[model samples]
Structure formats: C-alpha cells, structure tokens
Target chain A: EPEVTQTPSHQVTQMGQEVILRCVPISNHLYFYWYRQILGQKVEFLVSFYNNEISEKSEIFDDQFSVERPDGSNFTLKIRSTKLEDSAMYFCASSESISGRARDEQFFGPGTRLTVL
Target chain B: EDQVTQSPEALRLQEGESSSLNCSYTVSGLRGLFWYRQDPGKGPEFLFTLYSAGEEKEKERLKATLTKKESFLHITAPKPEDSATYLCAVQEADSWGKLQFGAGTQVVVTP
Candidate 1:
C-alpha cells in the first residue's frame, strides 16, 4: 500500500535556530496535516492544508510555524525559532477525500523526532 | 477545546484473552471518531471510523464501537501480533479535518 513518507527521521537543532520538516504524502491524496506529540502526551493537531492553503490551525501553530507545498508531492513544516517545548515527534498525514460533510480517514507518516537544545 | 481521554493506559493479556480499550471525548459537532494502531517508533495505522452514535466497525479480531461521548475498541481472542498501542481520535465538524487524538492505550498480548 502507498504510505506517507517524511524526511529526516530525527533532527537536533539549537534553540532559536530554524528547521524544516519535510513530508511527501500519498500521491493522489488531497488534504495534508501536521501534528505533534510531546513525550507522554496526546497527539496535538498543528495545522491542516488543502488546495495549497491553510485550512485551520491550533494555538500551538503560532507565528513561528509555517507550512508549504513547494511541489506536487512535497509538503513541509518550518519552525522559525525552535524552543525547548518544540521538541517532540512531528507527524505528517494526508487524506484521499472529504466532501459534503463526509469524513475521510487520514494516513500518517512515521514522524520526525525533533529535538531542540 | 476538544478533549480525548483513554482509559487503562496500559494492558497485558495472555494469548486468547479478550479485552477492551476505552476512549472518551468531548467535541462540538463531532464529524467522526477514529481508531488506529501504532507500533513503537512508527506512525498510527488507521483501523476504523465511526461516524455516529451506535455505529460499529470491525476488522479481524478488532471491533470499534462509538457513542455520543465515548468509543470502545474490543479485541477478541487476541494473539501476540495484536500487541501495540491503540489510539483514538476525533474530528469535529468545525475542525477543518484536523484530528484530536487521545493518549493511547498500550496493549501487550503474550503468547
């Protein structure tokens, strides 16, 4: 089966530095998302992207966070200024369809472990 | 705020033993409830989606049931291969397709 793929399985960055997490969602999928899970915490939604635009975002997705679909397959999340709290497992996901109030299940990537020091 | 809480953070079951995991959630205009399985160091693998109260879906030894306030994943006669962390998530009508996930329940099935 086709699956979502993310680059840089793990990353270590200095506080206040910038980092970009890249993902390649399933080729035919339309919607994409980013989520993070702090150690021993629930998975928290960060943002959703569709039609090359942000559809929704959470408080955690503040000024320092940005997402881009630079190409047909590459979706990326950039953190302008990493903080200690930014260290977590960031997952990328995509959905094949969603329309007319129907919900389409999302497929998740293995996730990138971001470590800020 | 949307919230999801799962019960029995961890569980251990002998081969052939059956049990259930619970997920309780609060969200406005719930669009769907989802169940996923995760192995260590891996991302969630989608299992099922429950769209309404009283809805149920099943695959292999797993059965997922949903209600207005909670969801249950029942494992019947499980085997060692069933050992994994089970995650439950919810999508609200206004979330724009973002998922709110619970702290998963880890299950260990010993053969």
Candidate 2:
C-alpha cells in the first residue's frame, strides 16, 4: 500500500526562526492538505492545495504560513517566524481524487512534531 | 462554519467489554464522515468512511455507523491492543478537500 510520507519527523526551532515541513504525498494523488493538532486539542485544518494553488485556508493560516508544491511529489508548509503556539504535530494528507462534491478519502502521513522555544 | 464534537474524552474497558463512541457534527450539505485511530506519536490510520445516513462499515473489532447529525463507532469485545485515540472528522459542505476534526475519544483497554 502506498502511503504519504513526511520529512523531518521532529523539528526544534527558535521563536523567531523559519522552518519548512515537507511531505511527499502518494504519487497519483491530486489534492493535498495540512492540519495541526496542539497538545490535548482537536486536529485543526490549516490549508488545502490543488492544481498547485490554495483552495481554502483557515484563520490560523495567516500571513506567516505558506504552502508550495515545488515538484511533482513534494508538498511543503513554511512558517515564517515560529511562535510558542506554533508548536504542534503537523500532518500532511492527500486524496487521489479532486471532486469537491463527492466523498474522497484522504491518506495521512506520520506527521512532524514541531517544537518552538 | 463546520464543527465536529466527540463524546467521552476518555473511556476504559475490560478485555471483553463492549462500548460505543459518539461523534456529532454541524455542517451544511454533508459530504462524508470518517473515523481514524491514532497511537502515540503516529499518524491517524483510516478505519471507515460513512457517506450518508444509514451507512455502516466494519473491520475487525470495530464498526462505524452514520446519520445526518452524528455517527457512532462501536467496539466489540475489545482487546488491550485496541487502545488508542479514535478521531472522527467531517468533510465540509462543498469543501474541495479540507476536513474538520473532533477532539477525539481516547480508549484504554486492560487485560
């Protein structure tokens, strides 16, 4: 079974530094997403990307956050300046289809644990 | 805005005990509801997907059922290895691919 994979399973960064979380979604998948879960909190949606463009984003995905599909297989999320609150487990997901109205299943990666100090 | 709520933040059961976890959602034009299990420091493993009311799916010791407003994940004769955090999420109405998730139900089974 093909699965989504992420790099830098764990990361530690300074409060004002920048960091990039990378993911290589299933090769044939067309839609990608980023979600975060704070300790003891719900998994929160950050953004969705399709056709190399952002489809939707949440309030938490503000000026400091950006996503890019630099190549065919890699999807990345960048944080311009890390904050204490930015520390969390970030998951990368992808679905093989892109029909908005139909039910599509997403495959998730193991996730990257980000720690900001 | 779409929202998902899960009941019983934590649950404990004996090796042969049976129990059910609930997930409630508030969203327009429901698309799909999903159930996943996550172990410590690992990604969520897909369990089931319910697309409409009266839909159900099962695997091993777990069964998932869905309605218009809520869903239930039933575990039968669960074992210690079944212990994990079970999360439920809903794909938003007209959403391209984003998913709104619940706080999850943590289940612990002891032998």
Candidate 3:
C-alpha cells in the first residue's frame, strides 16, 4: 500500500532557528494537511491545502507557520524563529478526495518529532 | 466551539480481557466520527468512521459504535499487540477535512 512519508524522523533545533518538516504524501492524493501534538495533548489541526493554496488554518497556525507543496510529491511545514513551545510531533496527512462515503479517510505519515532547544 | 472528551485517560488489561473506550463529543451537525489508534512516535492509524447514529463498524476484535452524543470502541479478547493510544475525532458539517480530536485513551494490555 502507498503511504505518506516524512523526512528527518527527529530534529533538534535552536529556539531562534528555522526548521522545515517535509512530507511526501501518497502519490495521487490532492488534499494535504499539517497537524501537531504536544507531548501529552490532543492532535491539533494546523492547516489544509488544496489546489496549491491554503483552504483553512487554525489560530495556532499563526504568522510563524507556513506550508507549501514545493513540488508535486512533497509538502512542507516551516516554522520561523521556533519557540520552546514549538516542540511537538508534526504530522502530515493526505487524502485523495473528500467526496466518498467512508472512503475518503486521510492517510498520515509516521510524523516528524521537532524539538526546539 | 466543538469539543471531544474521552473517558478513562488510561487503562490496563490482562491478555484476553475485553473492555470498551468511550468518546463523547459536542458538535453542530456531525459530519463524521472517526476512531484511530496510535503507537508512540507514530501517526494515527485509521480504524473506523461512523456517519450517523446507530451506525457500527468492526475489524477483527475491535468494534465501534456511534450515537448522537458519543461513540464507543469495544475490544474483545484483546492482546498485548492491541496496546496503543486510541483517539476519537469529529468532523462537523461546516468543517471540511479538519478534525476536532480528543486527547485519547491509552490502553496497555499485558500478557
């Protein structure tokens, strides 16, 4: 089965540095998303992209955060000037479409663990 | 605001034990209720998606049931391999592709 793959399984960066978490979603998926989970918290939605443009974003996806397809197969999340609170597991997901009944489930990548020092 | 609350934050069970995890949510016109399992250091693995009250779906020893206000995931004769954090999420009518997730229920099944 085709699955979403993320790069840099784990990353440690300085508080003021920029880090990019990359993901290659399933080959044919059209909808992409980014989500984050703190050490012991619920997974929170960050943003969603379709047609190479952002469709929706959460308040947590503030000015410091941005996402881009970058290429046909890659989706990336870049956080600028990371803060201590930015440490978490960032997940990328993709879905072929959202029109099917019980068939449009999102497929998630293994996740990238981002640690800000 | 939409909210999802899961009960019994953590649970421990012996091999072959059967139990259930609860997920309650408050959303406007629920589009779908989803169940996922996650191991440490990994993303959530989809288990089931319920679209309406009285709907049910099953896979091997796990069974999922949904109602208007809550959902339940029942595990029958569970094994150590089933030990994982089970998460519940909801998609409201107005939200497309965005899921409001619960904190999750951690299950530890010992041999």
Candidate 4:
C-alpha cells in the first residue's frame, strides 16, 4: 500500500538554528497536515494544508512555523530559530478527502525526530 | 473545545488473549473518530474510522466501535507483535481537516 514518507528520519540542531522537515504524501491525497509529539506527550496538531494554502492552524503553529508545498509531491515544514522546547517528533500526514464519514482517517509518516540542543 | 481521553494508560496481555481499549471524547459536534497504532519511535499508523455511534470496522485482529461519547478498539487473540501504543482522535465540528488526538494506551503482549 502507498504510504506517506518523510525525510531526515532524525535531525540535531542547535538552539536558534533553522530546520526544515520534509514529507511526500500519498500521490493522490489532497489534505496534508503536520503534527508534533513532545517526548511523553500527546500528538498535537500544528497545521493543515490544502490547495497550496493553509486551511487551519493551532496555537502551537506560531510565527516561527511555516509550511510549503514546494512541489507537486513535497510538503515541507520549516521552523525558524529552534528552541530547546522544540525538540520533538514531527509527523506528516495526508488524507484523500475531508468530509462526511471517511474524512477522519489520517495516514501518518514514520516521523522525523528533531533534537535541539 | 474538544478533549479525548484514553483509558488504561498501559496494558499487558499474553499471546492469544483478547482485550479492549477505550477512548472517550468531549466535543460539541461529533464529526468522526479515528484509531491508530504507533510503534516506539514511529508515527501513528491508521487503523479504523468510525463516524456514527453504531459504526464498526475490523481488520486482522483489531476491531473498532464507536458510540455517542466514546470508542473502543478490541484486540482478539492478540500476538506479541501486537504490542504498541494505540491512539484515538476526533475531528472537530467546524474544522475541515484538523484532528484532536488522545494521549494513547500502551500495550505489551507477551508470548
């Protein structure tokens, strides 16, 4: 089965540095999302992207965060000036459609573990 | 605001044993509920989607059921390989594609 794929399985960056996490969602998927899991914490929604624009974002997705569909197959999340608190596992997900009964299911990638020192 | 709570933070079972995991939610307008499984260092893997109170879906040893305020994931004759963290999430009422997820239950099945 086709699955979402993320690049740079693990990354280490210093505080105040920048990092960009990349994902290639399923080819036919339309809705894309970014979520993060702090060690020992629940998965938290960051942002959703569709039609080359942001559909919705949570408070966690603040000014330092940005997402881009740089190409037809690539969805990227960039965090500027990483902080110690930014250390976490960042996941990328995609869904075929978003409505009605089938809209709730989200297929997630293996995730990129970011470590900020 | 939407909140999802999963019961039994951790569980242990022997191979071939059967058990169920619970997920309860508090949301204004119910859109859909989802179930996923995660390995130690990986992202969540999609399992089932439940839209209505009576909806149920199954695959392999896993079966998922939904209700007005909660959802259950039943594992039948589980194997040691079935050990993982199971997560539950709810889609918000007005949001088009955002997901609110639960903390998840960690299961360890011994052979």
Candidate 5:
C-alpha cells in the first residue's frame, strides 16, 4: 500500500540552527499536516496545509515555524532556530479528502526524530 | 479548546486476554474520532475512524465504538503482537484537518 514517507529518519542539530523536515505524502492525497510529540507527551498538532497554504496552526507553531509545499510531492516544515525543547518526533500525515461522509482519516509517516543539543 | 483524554496510562495483559481502552474528548463540534497504534519510536498506524455517535468499526481482533462523549477501543483475545501504544485523536468540524491527540494508552501483552 502507498504510505507517507519522510526523509532523514533522524536528525541532530544544535541550538539556534535551522532544520528542515521533509515529507512526501501519499500520491494523490491532498491535505497534509505536521505534528510533534515530545518525549512522554501527547502528539501536538503543528499545522495543516492544503492548496499550498496553511489552513490552521497551533500556538506552538509560532513565528519560527513555517511549512511549504515546495513541489507537487514534497511538503516541508522548517524551524528557523531550534531550541532544546524542540527535540521531539515530528510526524507527517496526509488525507485524501476532507469533506462529506468520507471521514478524512490521515495516514502517517514513520516520523523524523529531531534532537537539538 | 479541544482536548482528548485517554484512561489507564498503561496496561499489562497475558496473551488472549481481552480489555478496552477509553478516549474521552471535548471538542466544539466533533468531525471524527480516530484510533491509531504506535510502536516504540514509530509513528502512529491508523486503525479505525468513528464519525458519529452509535458508530462502530472492527478489524481483526480489535473493535472500536463511539458514543456522544467518548470512544472505546476493545481488543479481544489479543496476542503478544498486539502490544503497542494506542492513540486517540479528534478533529473538530470547523478546524479543517487539525487533530488533537491524547497521551495514549500503552498496552503490553505477554505470552
């Protein structure tokens, strides 16, 4: 089955450095999202992208965070300056449709583990 | 504010034992409720999605039911391979595709 795939399974970055997490969502899927899970914490929504623009974002998705559909298949999340608290597993998800009776069940990628030192 | 709360942070069961996990959600307008299974260090794998009250879905040995206020994931006669963290997420009707997730229930099944 087709699945969402992310690049650089693990990343090690220093504080104040920039990092870009890339994801190739399932082919033919439109809506995309980024979520993060801190160690021993719940998965927190970061932002959702559709039509090449952000649909909604959480408070944690502040000025430092940005998402781009740089290409047809590539969706990326960029953090301008990483912090120690930014260390977490970032997941990329996509869904086919968002309206009607077809519940938009998202499929997740393996996730990219970001470690900030 | 949307919130998803899961009960019984952890559970241990012998092979073939059956149990249920709870996820209570508080959202302005419920669009959908989803169940996902996550292994250590891995992203969540989709299991089931419940759209409205009185809706239920089943897959293999797992069954998920939804009510007005909460949802339940019932694992029946589970095996050791069923061990994983079960995550529950909710989407609000007007929130587009953003999902609010719970802390998850970690289940460990032993042979």
Candidate 6:
C-alpha cells in the first residue's frame, strides 16, 4: 500500500536554530496536515494545507511556524528559532477528500523526532 | 473547544483475551470519528473511521462502534501482536482537516 513518507527520521537542533521537516504525502492525496506529540502528551494539530493555502491552524501554530508545498509531492514545515519546548515528534498526514463520508480518514507518516537542546 | 477523553490509560491482557477501549468526545458538530494504532516511536496507523452515530466498522479481530457521544474499539480474541497504543480522534463538521486527538490507551497483550 502507498504510505506517507517523511525525511530525516530524527533531527537534533539547538535552541534558536531553524529546522525544516519534510514530508511526501500519499500520492493523489489532496489535503495535508501537520501535527505534533510532546512526550507523554496527546497529538496536537498544527495546521492543514489544501490548494496551496492554509485551511486552518491552531494556536500552537504561531508566527514561528510555516508550511509550504514547495513541489507537487513535497510538503515542508519550517520552524524559525526552535525552543526547548519544541522538542517533540512531528507527524505529517494526508487524506484523499474531506467531503464524503469516511473519506476524511488520514494516513500518517512515520514522523520526524525533533530534539532541541 | 473539542475535548477527547480516553478511559483506562493502560491495559494488560492475556493472549486470546477480549476487551474494549473507550473514547468519549465533545465536538461542536461531529464530522467523523477515527481509530488509529500506534506502536512505540511510530506514527499512527489508520484502522477505521466512523462517520455518524450508530455506525460501526470491523477489520479482522478489531471492531469499532460509534455513538452520539462516545466510540468504542473492541478487540476480540486478541494476540500479542495486538499490543499497541490505540488512538481516537475527532473532526468537526465545519473544520477542514484538523483532527483533535485523545491521549490514547496503551494495550499490552502477553502470551
């Protein structure tokens, strides 16, 4: 089965440095999303992208965070000036459609573990 | 605000045992309820999606049922391979693709 793929399974970065997490969602998927999981915490939604634009974002997706579909298959999330609290597992997901029943189920990538020191 | 609460944070089951995991959610307008399985350090794997109340779906030994306020994942005759963290998430009707997730229930099946 086709699955979402992410680059750099693990990343180590220093505080105040920038990091870009990349994902290639399932082929033919139309909607993409970014979510994070802090250690021992629930998965939190960051943002959703469709049609080369942001559909919705959470408070956690503040000014420092940005997402881009730099190419047809590459979707990237950039964080400017990472903080210690930013250390978490960032996941990328995609879905085929959002309107039909049960069509919104998303498939997630293996996730990129970001460690900020 | 949407809130998802899962009961019994951890469960230990013997091989061939059967049990259920509960996910209760509060959302403005329910668009869909999803169930995912996650192993340690891995992303969630999609299992089933329940769109409306009274809807149910089954896959292998796993069965998921949805109600107006809660959803349940029943594991029947589970094996050691069934051990994993089961995650439940919700999507609001008015939202695009954002999913609100619960803390998840970790299951351990021993032989």
DockQ of each: 0.73, 0.67, 0.70, 0.82, 0.83, 0.88
Q: Which residue pairs in model 2 clash with each other?
A: none
Of the candidates shown, which would achieve the greatest DockQ relative to the real structure?
A: 6
For model 4, what is the C-alpha lDDT against the true structure?
0.93
True contacts kept of 6: 0.88
Candidate with the larger TM-score of 4 and 5: 5
Q: Write the per-residue lDDT of candidate 6 for residues A5-116, one digit (tens) a residue.
A: 9988999999999999999999899999999999889999999999999999999999999999998999999999999999999999999998848578899999999999
What are the per-residue Cα lDDT tens digits for candidate 4 across B6-99?
9989999999999999999999887789899999999898888888899999999999999899999999999999999999999976886888
lDDT of 1 by residue, B1-111 (tens): 449999899999999999999999988788888899989878899999888899899999999998899999999999999999999998887677888898899999998
Off by over 4 Å in 1: A100-103
Taking candidate 6, what TM-score does its chain B reach relative to the real chain B? 0.97
Supply the TM-score for candidate 5: 0.98
Candidate 5 per-residue lDDT over residues B1-111, each given as its tens digit = 448899899999999999999999988799899999999999999999889899999999999999999999999999999999999999889987988999999999999
A-chain TM-score per prediction? Answer: 0.96, 0.95, 0.97, 0.97, 0.97, 0.98
The C-alpha stretches of model 6 lying farther than 4 A from their native spots are: none
Better of 1 and 3 by DockQ: 1
Candidate 2 segments exceeding 4 Å error = A98-103
- What TM-score quantifies how close candidate 1 is to the native fold? 0.95
Candidate 5, residues A1-117: lDDT per residue as tens digits? 899999889999999999999999998998999999998999999999999899999999999999999878899999999999999999999999877268488999999999999
What is the lDDT for A104 in model 2?
A: 76
Q: Give a tens-digit lDDT track for model 4, residues A35-108.
A: 99999999999999999999999999999999999999999999999999999999999998878566547899
The candidate, 4 or 6, that scores higher on lDDT is 6
Best by TM-score: 6
* CAPRI quality of model 6: high
True contacts kept of 2: 0.71
Ranking of candidates on DockQ, top first: 6, 5, 4, 1, 3, 2
Task: Specify the poorest-scoring 10-residue window by lDDT in model 2 chain B.
Answer: B91-100
User: How does residue B22 of candidate 6 score in lDDT?
Assistant: 99
